[model samples]
Target chain A: MAQPNPHNTYLPGYKEVGHHEWRTAENSAPYLLPTLQSLAETNPSLTLLDVGAGSGTITTSLAKYIPQGHITAIDLSPDILSRAASHAASVNATNITFQPASVYELAQTFGPAAFDVVHAHQVLCHLDAPVQALAQMLAVVKPGGVVAVREIDMRVWSFHPFSETMRAWVEVQKATHAAAGGSNEAGPSLVAWAMRAGARREDVKASMGTWLYATEEERRVWGTSFRDRIVGGEMRKKALELGIATEAELDRMGEEWQRWMETEDACCGTLHGEILIRKPK
Target chain B: MAQPNPHNTYLPGYKEVGHHEWRTAENSAPYLLPTLQSLAETNPSLTLLDVGAGSGTITTSLAKYIPQGHITAIDLSPDILSRAASHAASVNATNITFQPASVYELAQTFGPAAFDVVHAHQVLCHLDAPVQALAQMLAVVKPGGVVAVREIDMRVWSFHPFSETMRAWVEVQKATHAAAGGSNEAGPSLVAWAMRAGARREDVKASMGTWLYATEEERRVWGTSFRDRIVGGEMRKKALELGIATEAELDRMGEEWQRWMETEDACCGTLHGEILIRKPK
Candidate 1:
């Protein structure tokens, strides 16, 4: 069992029902090559852990990739964890198990030297103590095992058919992250944070990956997901409470997303930082 | 013979020695997959044209990829063309030939339907008349063949260890492009430009690519290349003439590049837009 950290406040909160659709295991394809290679080198039956396993999209997807390997997918909210468990069941991902856990409790809950691989995607930026959380993660991974993390740098997000409303939307996102006391643009600092968490300089390797929305289908899917997250999700309430944007302003951004979807030649690209840290034997 | 367009002025001009090392065929790899597939489907002996082919790096590299195919590599400056020709010889690229030509002359110089494929890399954004040039490129490609173009969008370039001088460096680059009457951030509009250039809306496909410099070697190479471009290249004289930046400011930027090279965890990513338009049969 794990207890949630009282200090953590997540942005675009987990209550956003449709938010996870935008972050499927497919969205995480770029970060998986090295890990998949590692899995191949190791045994297929090795244990892996997924921290902050939102919606179980990536967790369930990983079940398919390593059918024989067992995965412990943990998150803080039982409500979200149950939902993710249901999703996993629906997808027939039997190799994955769920737990209500927080980043702060990972080492204690799982014990030391547990997982062969520890992976997190888009989770660190939302945590209040990412470096501390990383240290805990490092503790749970076996000596000589690897911990992989991927984070987005919204500062570099580029979108086509520029609109003032869209620009404000990006700013509001950054503000909301600040209001929640987390770093939204944490991609560039992953390597530095790993070092601060006690990983040696030589133990960390960094690379960049990208997310692009260009095709009509991709644009529509992304636009709808974001619009829903802002309009009907907890994000709308939080933003208004934080005074990041007015209700009417949020509504306008929602409308702008639909317009962006319809506009031909619309495109958006976001860069993500990937870090692989090896625990010394 | 092809004549240079009198109205055109290129930023970071061709006379910048060592500039071509940064843009080898490997740099253009992302844009080549579809084009390479097209080449494979077509006859191996089909003709290809490289407009604004700089340094003969991409041109000569392509020669090896398709040994039976022939490449006509064109640029505006005879001096640069001679250098590229010498480079091609040094590489022993037997299938490539260099020509001193401007984008404006492609149609008349090649005649209608002269080649199976036409490609341009980082060229359209610098041209005075990109749409006309694209239209000409379309006219020269065989019916059912493709015209591929790639342009950088500097507005979204992101770098780590942020400094005021580095920000100024990016702004000065945009300023120089503006002074030369070119669109520095032309990436997002690539699809629109292609449509305006006479391709039907449905005939064009757009994708985004990225350039990342993260490793120690990559940081040093990129930093050195830009420092040289700012210090000893034609760009320095042109920026001064255009009043884009003072000599002293440019020198400070050059020094900042050296500092950035030495800084650990330095990373930069630049996004580019790629377009492929198919001619109607």
Candidate 2:
């Protein structure tokens, strides 16, 4: 019999929720596109690998940029990969392929020196061994190719007219993630992780970016998504099981989220740490 | 005909950049100590007022569990107020007075209601009104009392694996502080500032805290000091002259400081947004 995986608590819901909220142009382009453009500038017909390619929103977008080139989108969830495949087909993005694979097993499955660029966004923070995953990412990228990673530095998450409910929610989220052996600190630590994973320090180019949800519509989307995640998703169950928050507290936080969404001047956003490293030729 | 104020550039190097290094057990204790104790169930006698009491590393320590007490330390840079009077006479302390006025004249120099608790740390974020200097520290406190403020949201200052000469330093540091005519995003936008200045939000209790450099001598200080002010303070001059980085850009950031310090695993600290507003009894 197969043993149950402890960290699997949050993954099932994450796949069903689909990451479509993050798929919007407003969220993805500011950080992902620039790195892709920079790489495209160097090799117009590059072959790229999109690791943890959630719903293929970013992958298909990258496919459009490299019309003559190709992209292989991979993920651990077959459900997400199926959705990603459907998304690629809907977009008529022919230059991409979708696969099911874990980032840790990438080198073994794809062979070494297989990609011109390897990219992942908001992914590594959820991995138990981000550095090892980076090593795998590095292994599959050809010499002189680029490996780009972007993750949110949760410490920078802030909002105006502070909310205690939001604060408690953030605490619960962090504790749940930590209990699952993941990190919210992954974003700011990207460069350090890359260097530790065998990339030379001098070869890493680090930058910071943000996703601001300030306008009414944007805030509605952001707040509602978070409210659903907290009140309706498995996160609430995971949090309770972990003893990170009681049900009453979670209910209070959900109400707080509703109140926050209704506040006129309310705005919130997150910071992302981005890094682009060139594999030594 | 008036001579230009030399200190206008950055407050004459903030006499207590000593607060920047945060090396002593005494320095870290004040801010962290009281908050923890307050969460405990106790009456905690505290007749306090710490107006711009720079480096009074003791105001907060005294705030902890003072069952029958008073504390009033004020400052407007008298030579006697040097380094917050040697951090309250280097520990052999007695609750006392150190006054000099001007938190917008302070209810005609401490007249109305005069105390139960009226505190300020890193006061008024350089006050261009400062909600009428927090309505003169809420008309000198005591109709249910408790007025506290702490600021500094240095979100635009960044350095990476050590930028050759701190590239973005001059641009961001100046724009953020200058944009507000004060601080980038001083602590929680003082509730008293809101209530006194006619913001619709009701008075609310808010608290924010931060980690400071303690051990690991190499990480001893990761904050801007007057030394940086005196020697490398061209940021003020550059911001005014070039206008390369906009006020909008400065307003959007609050993560740069965290990223820079973490790169070297260097110890750094931030003053947090804290507010405690008590409704009339």
Candidate 3:
């Protein structure tokens, strides 16, 4: 039997209800399309690895880009990994293989130089050892292959009809994430993290992306989901356990989200930092 | 003679030193390309208006998209307008016409339904009356034409190798801009402003864009230009005038930029909000 994965302490657990709906792979993976398409064209039979492949949503959607390519999706939680496998089967994504693994153990599981591309989205920021995780990811990619990662640069979130409660919610969220040893605003630090992982600066390409929520429908989807996460989900549980916020305060935040959703002129956006690190040939 | 354009109190005057090189037209206008290209295809002889056409850098570049079209570039400052005219001449952008004008006078100057598109970039945020200016822009556009605007949503800036002084710099910049009666963070509120200016919610389309400076060269260019603006250029003058920061503090902020440029692991990004509103046909 294997020892437990310590990084399982990732805030806002994915198994929490509504996590799948709030962050689907299809919605989140569009930003990575162009790069993945280019890679697929360059190597039709590419072997790609998706670390921290929560819900396997992005991994399965990525399958069509290279019909001839194979994707091995891994997550720390077997429960989520099994669900991801069932999802891939239901979606007819025949090219993907699901497995349970840790981000820190990529080299041991796949051996060195095993993959053509190693990718993780919104993953690194949650780890206490992101630099080491990146190093392990770099170790498993073939020379001349690439490792791509994207994480929310949560330092600034833009919202309209701004409310004090919402602002407090953002602060509390960041505080809790930090207390758990994750970097909430990890977007801009990607290049530095890659460089620290032993990749040369020249081989790293850094860019920015964004997620916008406006219109009544978009606001409702994001607002209500976020409210649920804050009030009754893993985030709430973590906040209470960590004493980051009192139960009354968490309840107020949930109400604030409701108010925000009801406002006629509501808009919110979060910026993301993305990087592509090519293994030196 | 023109009552000294009240909006000319715009913070960080353009005529101030180093302004032109810091924000050239070409670098600032790429975000509007797809929209311009699509409009060009729809109407080859597109009669477009570039409001606040500072330095004519973006205006001259926009000329190529609609070779058959004509552009009337307007600004409140005759001094900058002359420079813009000279720039257009040097670049052989024969289709562009530069003139001295104010955002509030657009309808009176161009007449109603005079152009196919009225576009502004980094323009509206500096006004005491952005909604009125937007309404004027709408008035001058043809019934089916579009009015497009992009503004820095200054609410959040993402930077790496974070520093307290640099953070203080951001706060002071916002404060000075606000003191001048400008909305420094006009990006996210664009839709609200448009609606207040009489645009229907359905007719407005909102999106987000970003400016990234990460590479050594990029960091140097942005950092140094910003330092110049903070220490000796328009920003410094405005900061002192508004009493937002002491001279010594402003000097330190400028030095901080220099230090940041020298730091190998430097990255910064700013988010902008963009909107396109179509006149109801």
Clash totals, every prediction: 0, 3, 2
For model 3 chain B, the run of ten residues with the poorest summed lDDT: B1-10
lDDT (Cα, tens digit) per residue for candidate 1, span A227-263: 8867866667778888888989999999999898897
Find the candidate with the highest TM-score and give its number: 3
* lDDT tens readout by residue for model 3, A156-244: 88988777888889987887777767997699899889989998888998888777788788888788888888888777887888887
lDDT of candidate 3 at residue B30, scale 0 to 100: 52
Give the lDDT ranking, best first.
3, 1, 2
lDDT of 1 by residue, B1-281 (tens): 45456455445564555646556666665566557656756688978899988777888877777788889999877777788889889989989888887778787887999988898998888877788888889989999888888888877766777788888888877877767778765887788788888898678877766777777887888888888878866667777887878999999989988888887767777778888888999
How accurate locally, in lDDT, is each candidate?
0.79, 0.63, 0.82
Candidate 1 vs 3: which has more TM-score: 3
Model 2 lDDT, residue B222, Cα = 46
Ranking by TM-score: 3, 1, 2
Highest DockQ among the candidates is held by which one? Answer: 3
Q: What is the DockQ of candidate 2?
A: 0.05
Docking class of 3: medium
Give me the displacement of residue A84 in model 2, in angstroms. Answer: 1.8
In candidate 2, the second chain superimposes onto the true chain B with a TM-score of 0.33
Instruction: Give the lowest summed-lDDT range of ten residues in model 2 chain B.
Output: B1-10
